[model samples]
Target: MSPDADPRSAPTSPRPSGLWRTVAEIERHVATDGWGAPLRLFALVRTADALDRDPGLARRLPPNVLDEARADPDHLTSVEQEGVPAVADLDELLGQLAWPDGVDGAALVVERILVPPDAETEVRAVTAGDDEAGRARALAAHPLAEDVRIAVGVLRDGRHECAVRSRSKDSDGEVATGADLVPGLVGALAATLQD
Candidate 1:
């Protein structure tokens, strides 16, 4: 999805809520840049609150977005966090993250190579003793491996949303959206909102 694409124009499954729409928007926004991008972190703030804190945003946001924010109290605006440290391990990165009171939630956009289920055993064995870089190379070279970009969002109230787009089927229409798509990633994101 292009940066200028309307968030509401994206197709979603099972009817999307405000949080889900925000997550999907983030997924599309990142997808525009194509693959091999680094991990991205976003701060999800209530749209009403964001506008209240920064009135100038009213002019920058897309048309009718501010109006929708005014109509829906649960609407969220995602602000990308820049200059994030390069971390080899996602778990370690998320474990050290702590959101402030102003942040209503957090979202993480990451690209991963997924091997077919039948190749899991062999893939693990081949990369068992390799370092992170070695494992990444091995996975990328695997014939059955598929590259996927996953965006997961979690709210302080325990709400979660996930969007997954594979390189093979890279398009706004092909994105898969659901609540429990990536439970583990959702859990890790939720931990960041913890006290």
Candidate 2:
């Protein structure tokens, strides 16, 4: 089965039940810091039988899907493979999610991208270049390509979010998002289960 087709292939889980609280903290940061680009959130969930109870899986799934996993979970199925429809009211959206009878756990991967305010001008310049090399060079110099800060975070079955990857001025270049970025809050939303 395709990795996206099987939840068993999903990454190991993060600390359960801590994801939501962690997410709340992250959200506050996002609210204050604000995103320079649109933030996207993706959720991956599998059947309860599939998780096999591995504790660390789903704790750190990147925003992208996994190609393979060591041991696939049983009765694996997809809950929401595509990006969530809306993040405008992320807290309210997360508050409405719940796992049905068959689902075991899930991972929430949030990506916040920041493009330099002047990216459009740079892109136009790149497109106007006559040769491939010139175009490539121009594109490389664009803020969207180089001057970008991405925050990626994963939250799983447990309530709390964990292991964030991000690019904040404060973070020296850690792969995980910190409070300076907002994936933590997004992670919490995905891990949380509400009525």
Question: Model-by-model lDDT, in order?
Answer: 0.91, 0.44
- Lowest lDDT block of 10, candidate 2: 63-72
Model 2 deviation from the true structure expressed as Cα RMSD, one decimal place: 16.4
Q: TM-score for every candidate vs. truth? A: 0.86, 0.33
Model 1 lDDT tens row, 109-178:
9999998776766766777575667777877788989999999999999999999999999999999999
Best by lDDT: 1
Compared with the true structure, the alpha-carbon lDDT of candidate 2 equals 0.44
* Model 2 stretches astray by more than 4 angstroms: 1-80, 111-161, 168-173, 177-191
Best model number under TM-score: 1
Query: Which residue pairs in model 1 clash with each other?
Result: none
Clashes of each: 0, 30
Give Cα distance to truth, residue 118, candidate 2, Å: 27
- On a 0 to 100 scale, what is the lDDT of residue 148 in model 1? 95
